[model samples]
Target chain A: MDGGGSAATIDHLFRRQHGRMVAVLTRIFGMHNLKLAEDVVQDAFCRASEIWKVDGLPENPPAWLMAAAKNRALDAIRRERTARNFAPELDRLLRSEWTVAPTVNEHFGANAIRDDLLRMMFSCCAPAISEESQVALILNILCGFGVDEVAGAFVSGHAAVEKRIARAKKILAASGMLFEVNSASEFATRLPAVQRALYLLFNEGYHGACAETAMRTELCREAIRLIREVLAHPNGAAPASFALAALMCLNAARIPSRKDHSGNLQPLSDQDRSQWDRDLIAEGLRLLEHSASGTELSQYHVEAAIAAAHANAPSTEATDWRQVVSLYDMLMQIQPSPVVALNRAIAVGQSEGPERGLMALDAIGGSERLARYPFYAAARADFELRLGHRDAARAHFGDALAAARNPDEKRYLAQRLAACGDVSAPLQR
Target chain B: MAEFAYLYRGGQRPSSPEQSQQIMQKWVAWMKELGEKGHMVDRGQPLEQSGKLVKAGNRSVTDGPFAEAKDVVGGFTLIRAKDIAEAAELAKGCPILERGGDVEVRPIMQMNM
Candidate 1:
């Protein structure tokens, strides 16, 4: 029996239960004491870890955690000072002894959990919150991630993420966001922001600058989990959201081959196709088909189509490069950005010659945004290497190395640069 | 055998899944070692930081025994060892130290009826 596996089961359950538990507790504790509710949930995890260490795994872990948290809430209410600080909403509900138990029970009931979680999720990503803050709020409040975990997922430094989340939480607390279960129209208006946060979450998981592979994949799994929450609700599953989920599914399917056995980075051109998760690819293809049902052509739809082309191919050489290039074209038409342009150039390299790809890259070089981007220089180096421009490849790789965020990337670029050694050296003469 | 309290202090949670797992494995191994040596009284409970201290006389409440994170005693463990030195020796095995935490080993007092 693997202890690590059991530990992972506990971790997974925490994520699954944390949001629902927080939602219900928030309803009982009131909006003002949201931080207190979070504290109680953290306490529950501590209790679980200790008890499980001694008695082994419980028969029903979630029930155990809920009961522990409920008792803690009771203890808090018993305390005069804390109870007096409850928001008016909760204070009124808890005024009488007769109403207190039933009120807490009613709020924590199974039926209320799902609705509460949905409402809280919507509240976290409300249009008023900034984009990055919204993502941090969802991860911290809804997903039960710590500041460190949130930082790791987003590839942001810890101190910055801590401050960002703190500011976001203060704003949310001040907003006194009511837990209104939104009607379809209200949900429709806010779905885009929620989708954007989830999209960013998924992209960070897929393209994280983080050195650790496990941490990166955990983010991807979390994004998929949260995206499922969006799709579970009938009105919340917009076509664009579905497209985004399909895009994640396709990208995630390739995760197994993304790193080598020694945990170094593996480029797509060298990755083992047999290691690709076929189940995830099939699911992704299914989602892609579903996404096509609505006439709305989200950038995600185009991106997912491009990913599907890659997933369906037997090998890099066998990939439908033309299809990828066209989808990228569509993506550029919808969501024009330096990153999109960079991706298009790479596909163009595969479809046309390396020279054409270099030209496409040069056209986008005018953007100040791509100047510091390591991947832009890295892409240029890849094309130059293919075209036998050893000196140019070395220079571009050096630029990439200078801009690399993590040691893994720098090392990879260094190796690529070393491979492009000059035949025009004095030693060769 | 005598009981001692091992007060845990100052360990940040691991920033990554891999780091957490590695830390957990060390903890599990240490616990197993204690159990094998018949020194494990109980695995111990982790304490949450939010607590209101009941004042000496007026019964006014102020926030927490340790207001700042560094001064906070995160949790305590009760373990049986032959002597204080043995208990202190046991603290050396604590996994939290790997993450820059410390263990304060103090002997427990017993009273006769």
Candidate 2:
């Protein structure tokens, strides 16, 4: 038959299908056979591409693909005499006729497949690796992100990002970690690391420095979807997960407002509050409230609370800096990072005085991580500007402008430099 | 039953003779397993990465297998199955996955032009 049938689907059908099939197969084959499971899924997509050019698209494309993938997996198993060496248990499991069915639901129940995907996420984001590596691996395997997309997220080279992912996968494989959704207590222990990974993924998407616009949106949406999945499951849902979701929602509500009509980045102060997604804002607020109901407050709970306050404000002038500062203080107690302190310093500058903010910033000392961060320079410039130190503000703004990767950010820094009014002579390096 | 061919893509990078022999040993072990299960249609063998792709229009022939190592079609396997689904079910157990390689499972077209 002509393979024209499957060619009509959306572009990412293969990639998305690849993830689902891998999750389902991994559930059946066990995590140690992840490579085999992923290969089977990839092969199914390759077959679809070839046959769909002639046979036309299937009536139920996903089901057709799943059935094809399952069959390929089974055939490969039957052919391998040494499968006993690698996966004896999986070989036994495959011998049973129930796993490889013609129908998708018959092979992998719908709910079971979804649970497997969630389990894959938890396993990929285990606390064994650095948070940076965890997010990169999740984006690669779960989201089907390319090396370049992940590299853009980290503001680093593609090779560096690829190495990070390869290393993370090796670590996971070596640890003999299995893909299984954890119980409430187990999830609770790992929840913080998972939350951090999700937040980093969201930030990467929201920043929009990546190559494909849709990819960034997908990352944001997927993070939200996974967080919601966690919240829906009885054992998976936790206050921390809810708070992380709320924070993402609050931040995402501003996505449409962040960029202007010309697609330029609009600073929070310059954004039109009316452009924000009110439904999302309301949802974020409700989640924040639920998160706060618990006695133990997490960094996410405080961050979401702070984001909620910003969303509720009608204008930058209307923002309750005192409340934001207090939340920042609470966050600092929970997670002591120079980045958090820098953010709190900005809040302090607005609430109290630039002098107080400067003192807080200075007390933190030099942080190597933030040394290259443009936001740190921007914050210093803002504090300097508020203190009427025009020369110092101009120099710091120049530093920020040089370091800013996004064009809109560079423009904003230039504008800030102009506002400093040190135009008499060009500022020296 | 329909015969399916699995294209195994590996050895994109030049390897030592020793490494190539090791790979072949693994392939032989794999083939033995498939043969015993009665899944083997014929004795499948690997082919060198030197071939031409003829385009439909003008029937233009491209240079010998010019593509990225990852994109190159490496080798193939012929297996017997009840249907396309059955063929795909068999392709899953291939060892290519361990080496970060891919398999292309396709039903052998019955009719010739």
Candidate 3:
């Protein structure tokens, strides 16, 4: 491990350390100086890179970075703070330089870091902040995601992410909110937003917003890790959270088989069943069972059940399509949206028939956003192709190809378009 | 043509991962431009704040190379140019300057063997 020290080690340490470091530093410096906390953590990494280039990675690299951050944090406080009782939390050890390291250690210790990360997540997902900003803050501050990544997640530009994060920090600073652990009641209000952000994070990774070269399993992993952290806490665990976790697990299980060799989005039908992670599916099923005890079903519960169905099915054709369609029906009742309708229509085609699916999609029409949704048109083309309506399939495929944003998607649509081409030019034959 | 070193200095390092990545992209693009023009003699790197400084003819080794944070040279790049003016012109597109920083373009004097 020591001899084979690579950038991968630092990359791993960076993801692990950044959020925890920011959290502990935020606990000390307050959210008002969260930027300083982040800068100090970043500086520690820069220093580590320089030193490690010559000295090799230290025996305990994470500990080494933590020590550097601790020193930098103390230096920041001493230089910036007025000669007053700035940190009342450290009144016990503030008098002595010897205690400074101990005090910092106490906050940055594993258990304390875990607690701080939870608190930081809650603070970022504070209901007061707008939902988008909450997500941007979590990705930027906690998850170590770059602006490009977040913006890419958004399917938007970097400028918007910069502004969103800036606005989020402003809200956090001015909201006069304590970064301490939230009360059971307070956490109850915040949990929904936190769960929403986490789910979105997972989905963004699963169905990328850009032409991502890599799968970004890290994002999905981080989302699951945070969800688990929340579920581990007494205040945070609820039926909904467990359901969300179950959904994430079920989806993540299939992530390995989501893409083909050419980097095209592999339909569930075309995916290699052998590549699916059985252990993950088992865990997800276990979590889904636990969620069943709750009186009221959340959207997570509905979604997770659908995912579980797919996970358990031996093949896509053998799946309980009717059950999936029913789940989507429930979902529509709970949260009716054009996207849901589009998904439901495809599922309906599997359960019912292609013509019925086309009818459902036709009903879902009107929104410009849905009109531009590649999946909606692709699904329509798929249903049309199934029903032997070659011209309609070709027309729908044309729309799908035009709407395709990424190369894989474009390639997939091109193939489908070519399939329709033989029938589309029947007059030539 | 003369060789020159562009010493990049004083830009406040980004406080967040997102910001740092954007800054990194700009630098890569800037370096790519220099590389494409065949002006890049050496693709230099950003420096950390910590380094030992040996003074008094290498007799006294001090703790650091920096007197102040802002005065620290963040990175340097070697390039070929006609003269100091052309080197300075090449430095004009430096990414650090977009942030609060300046590029010190100095000609590499040709020493006789």
Candidate 4:
């Protein structure tokens, strides 16, 4: 048997089980005991790693983990009954010897675990928490990402990320309840925030300046998984959720071509179209169509529409730039940000000539907001190069290279800078 | 080739899911390498931390095997090698060493009955 396959299975088993066990234990132990819940889950994995080394692997690893975690939960409850309180709702029941086992057993059921996971997701993204903290909590608590991984994703330090998660958890515990997932009105009110958090999560993964391709994909996959969970529930089937799902799927479909064989960043113009995943593109299109049933027009809808436009095109030049420009206009109306305006200006560049693209960039009032944005300089450089303004193009490319976040981006800009003197160089297609 | 026992001693616990995963992969890969080299005899089971130890003089059983946390034998595996040196050399590849654990390699006495 191939060892690689088994290795992947074991890796997946541990990470996936970490999330599952934490969610279940949190449900039984209460939000205040979040750290305790994590400790219990961590202990279970530690045991598995020690034991499984000798035994190879159990017949059903998930089942084995589930059983192990259940016993640990029971042990924790019995040992701390006097010293600690559980989910306020279950406090009395968990304290008594008569009901503690059954109470723990009831929550550990497969169905309960599923609900608990969703509850955990919603709680992590609760509106009271800051957006950064929400993202950190989702990674740490819901996705079982370590502090270091969260730090890596944010491009921040370990201590900062740790503080953010701790603060978010404190706010969560003070609320003293898992967001009631079954309440329709509350779900409606909070669904948008949850959707936003997931969208941010996907964007962080897709457009991450971080160098680790493996981690980028993991974050993207986790976002997609949680989004699907949101859509699976009856109350979570919002039009915006469908649009968000489509947006993620379509973008994720292009992940394979995001980097070249040497692991350098590949801009959309340079990426080979054939490398895009057809299945994911198809699924994204289907979801986009489904999202159209409702009249609500979310930024995700317009964004997904833009992605669908690109997905359907045979090439970047063949893509309907006018249609893309219109979608961006819609996106601006729904969500006006400097980044959106910058992208809109670039789309205008594609549809119009180099002169018009330059004018559009200049017309974007408060353009200084994009001064630190590397892509803004890069876009200007592209327009300048296409217009045969070699001196201007060279300067802008230098600016872009200086502003670029990662080595891959810097290399791409450096290459573009080198081409400014090549009068024979063709305009970027 | 002679049968030898690999007595795995205490190691540090993995702090993160990803780290635990990497450690597990290292182990599985190590064993696969041994198996392919025809050195793996029997992959053993881990001994539970809690167990009974029978006292020799009193002929009484009590909850024991309470070795120092770092010295306790956590698990064992049986393998075939040319000799103790070869077995010890092969044991060097065990993942536990990365976590500060050690492996005691000893040959099983052969009976000529």
Candidate 5:
């Protein structure tokens, strides 16, 4: 076996198998024994690590893991049957030697594992838990993230993340309903919460107020991967889900150019348009079109439209700011926030003028709410600078610099401030 | 070249999926590196934490290699090296050491039957 090849395959298999094995085991063990299911999956991975390190990867890595997990499941059932209850539904079936292998095998079947994963996703996204906890649970259980990775994603402490996941798991297990996919109406109501959690997951990665670009990308990729799971199920293929997928894909397409090789923040204007992933953009556009069939206008639809507009533009100057402004208007109506208003005001600056943009920003009802947001001040500074109000630009840039949390963002703002000081420099558009 | 044994000891189970995957990847990569460097002899198996420990007199057999106890011999590997010093140096690259486990490097004595 080629060492490098086997190592890379094991890494991929670990990521792809970890959540799946857990989900399948959870289906067998019930939500109450989620921890036990996780333990079994962990055991399988540990066994694989030890064996595969020497034996090299099996011809069918996933099948190998499934076999390992199945054996572990059988062992767990046999050991604990007398002392504990398994999944309420399968407890009886699991207790009998005759049915045990078949029962575990049934759940571990390919189709069963996919459905179980969907159920696990919905369970993690249950509305009973807070959104933050929901995202953390999804990362931990569905994306196979460790507590440390979850903490890294959220820029939180290990203890806090651990507690959050535990509390959320308790709530989910206690809910006694792992979100059965039987009813369309119930599924419809629950889908929004799931979508929201996934959106937040993607945003945390893309915006990444936290450092560690690699981890941030991992979050985004996981979000995309899990969303595809939701989209794969017949009931999950709603317009909003399509829109959500579109929004994620379009925004993700720009991730390559979002930062320079040295990791400095690259503003949309300065980003290398050619570096944008065209394939993702195309897929996003197709999803956007699919999303248009439904009459319901979701925040995702509006947001994805804004992203599509950016994706279509050859450069910042070529972008249809008017269309972007209109989309922002729709987004504001759907999901009004200071962030939306701030974005709208920036678009207003581009489509209308710096003067109009300032007026729009001032007219925002909760303008004070955005006082701490670095981009709020940065947008104002951009408008001020473009209008040749160097003094005002300098002040706003200074404010942005003070508020910016990310070092790259802070450096960008500082550079903008310094540029404001150089009066002889040609006015940047 | 002489055969060397790398005895892995005292690493806890990984607490999370990410950590589990990382440990596995590291071990695989390290083993591969060793193989590429012409040091690999045989990839060894991980020992079960619970096993029969027989007394010399066969008067008692106990279950353990207790996992909870510190410094439990967990797993091992075999490698080819020039000497004890080279074997120990090669053993330093084992992934278990990253988790604060020790690798007991001992030469497999050549025997004539």
Candidate 6:
């Protein structure tokens, strides 16, 4: 047992290593043997927990686990052969004994395992799966999320989420999809899908679906980490990935200020700028600059720029609503979503006038997708409040509160309702 | 230090045969890269979804490879290492990690023959 190694040091080792081991093994064996491979891997981890409990931790815990898994896999293969019913193809694989020699730099080399993991990420988030499933799968496999955690991300129940994952895996196996990162051209084509996955992940964190504690922070941080990893890789890094990283960082900078001392939600207007993380803000700005190096602006780039403007502001009043509106305009042109248009209308209300913002919001008949979205109601409430329509504002605020999932968000809406002279607050109940 | 097997799991949703071909090609390329780097030792055969597990004194025979939808084991690779750390480091480069699958690392117990 290595004295230097501690459980805290390898906190998520079992979870994170789970994905990496699966990927490397799958690469060696074909996808058909996935079930056996996973069992071997899990057995290895279980053994580690048992051994480490008595013998103390290994110096390189991850490597120790990997080695155990390999031995078990070899044993399983041999056992299968003795049954004489072993597949001829597997028999061939068992016959070839390849050994990995250890070099000082070989372990934890930057390109060694990280590259495989990234490739795996790209493959899992392939455009083949629907965006919803992609996020769900990534959260479960890559992030080690349980079914309940994933279910919380959607409005659906646990069973529905389970079925979705089961259905996804069935499709993947039936389709015989091999796990590999797309080529440069293919990556370019699939960039949107990857970006969407990251975006959805960030949103899950931002919207506070997973949990109330630092889980949101973890999700946001991981989303940025993944996007950064993509951008850092020569072949994997696309401008959009960088933009997404920048956007996430910018949003993340305000995370500390998002919640008050009592853990109540603080709207942008009330959040203390001093609480924002300047270092993260700087990183966000730098990445945003790198993302804008190209002539064409992606929606992610525009969104990041908008977020950057907010981060740079010392107060809500200092936010460059004009620039934000302009970027939103560009974003609408590139990827016109009702959500984007709705957000753009908010910027217009701030930069141009409430009347123009109202007109813009009214032009787009509320899409069904926006029906359950709390932000739509919140934005409507804000617009109506500014236009002196107190009654309308109160009603919209109530709608926003009903749609709100997070306790903090519900509190924020309740406060807003109170301000609108609605003495009766349902939240108090 | 130890031997490790990185396991890949989970199945792809249905797709066109052409897409399946493309995925296979990628898998081959990835394996080739690992082989070239000398990180690959014994590669396990890709097993079909069906298999029987015999366990306990009764040697109970159950439906083979029966697991929850997402918990299936797909494939594995056996790599020798100085220790578990080295094996884990090698497992990091596996492509299956991206597909919501996991890599399990373990040490091989030397059998006295």
Candidate number achieving the greatest DockQ relative to the actual structure: 5
Weakest 10 consecutive residues of candidate 1 chain A by summed lDDT? A420-429
**lDDT, candidate 2, A259-335, per-residue tens:** 77876667787898899999999999998877876577887888899999999999877899999999988988898
Candidate 4 or 2, higher lDDT: 4
Query: What's model 1's lDDT at A184?
Result: 85
What proportion of the real contacts between chains A and B does each prediction keep? 0.07, 0.00, 0.10, 0.53, 0.66, 0.00
User: Between candidates 1 and 5, which one is better according to lDDT?
Assistant: 5
Candidate 4 on A109-133: residue-level lDDT in tens?
8878887888888888887898878
For each candidate, what TM-score against the reference?
0.84, 0.72, 0.79, 0.92, 0.96, 0.71
Worst 10 residues of 3 chain A by lDDT: A1-10
Candidate 1 clashes between residue pairs 3 or more apart in a chain or in different chains? none
Tens digits of lDDT, candidate 1, A1-429 = 223335546655766677887787777777777888777776666666555544455667789888888877766666643435665667766766777777777777876787788778777886677888988888877777778888877778999999998888777677675446658888888788778888887777788677777777877887888888888888867888889899999999999998778766778988888999999999999888888887899989999999999999998889999989999889889999999999999889889979999999998855588878888998898888888777888899999999988888887778777777956442110
lDDT head-to-head 3 vs 4, winner? 4
Could you report the DockQ of all the candidates, in the order they appear?
0.19, 0.03, 0.10, 0.47, 0.64, 0.02
- What's the lDDT for residue A411 in model 2? 70
Candidates 3 and 4 compared: the better one by TM-score is 4
- In candidate 1, how many Å is residue A263 off? 2.7
Going through the candidates in the order shown, the clash numbers are 0, 29, 1, 0, 0, 56
Once fitted onto the true fold, the runs of candidate 5 whose alpha carbons sit more than 4 angstroms away are A9-12, B66-68
Candidate 5 CAPRI category? medium
Model 3 CA deviation exceeding 4 Å by range: A1-3, A6-11, A83-101, A213-215, A365-367, A423-429, B1-113
* lDDT score of residue A329 within candidate 2: 86
Residues A129-158 of candidate 6 have per-residue lDDT tens digits of 788888877776666555676676565699
Clashing pairs in 4: none
- Cα misplacement distance, residue A39 of candidate 5 (Å): 0.8
- Pairing residues by index, what is the TM-score of model 2? 0.72
Candidate 2: which stretches are off by over 4 Å? A1-11, A53-57, A81-90, A96-107, A207-215, A367-369, A419-429, B1-113
Q: Candidate 6, after superposition: displacement of residue A317 in Å?
A: 0.9
Candidate lDDT values, in order = 0.78, 0.71, 0.78, 0.86, 0.86, 0.68
Q: Residues A1-429, candidate 5: write the lDDT tens digits.
A: 654585555554676777888888888888888888988888888888778766676787889889999999999999989988888888999999999989888888788899888888888887678998988998888888888878888988999999998999899778764677657887888899999999999999998688677877788888889889989988999999999999999999998998888888888888999999999999999999999986989999999999999999998889999999999988888899999998899899888999999998988897787898899998888888988899999999999999987777788788888999998987665
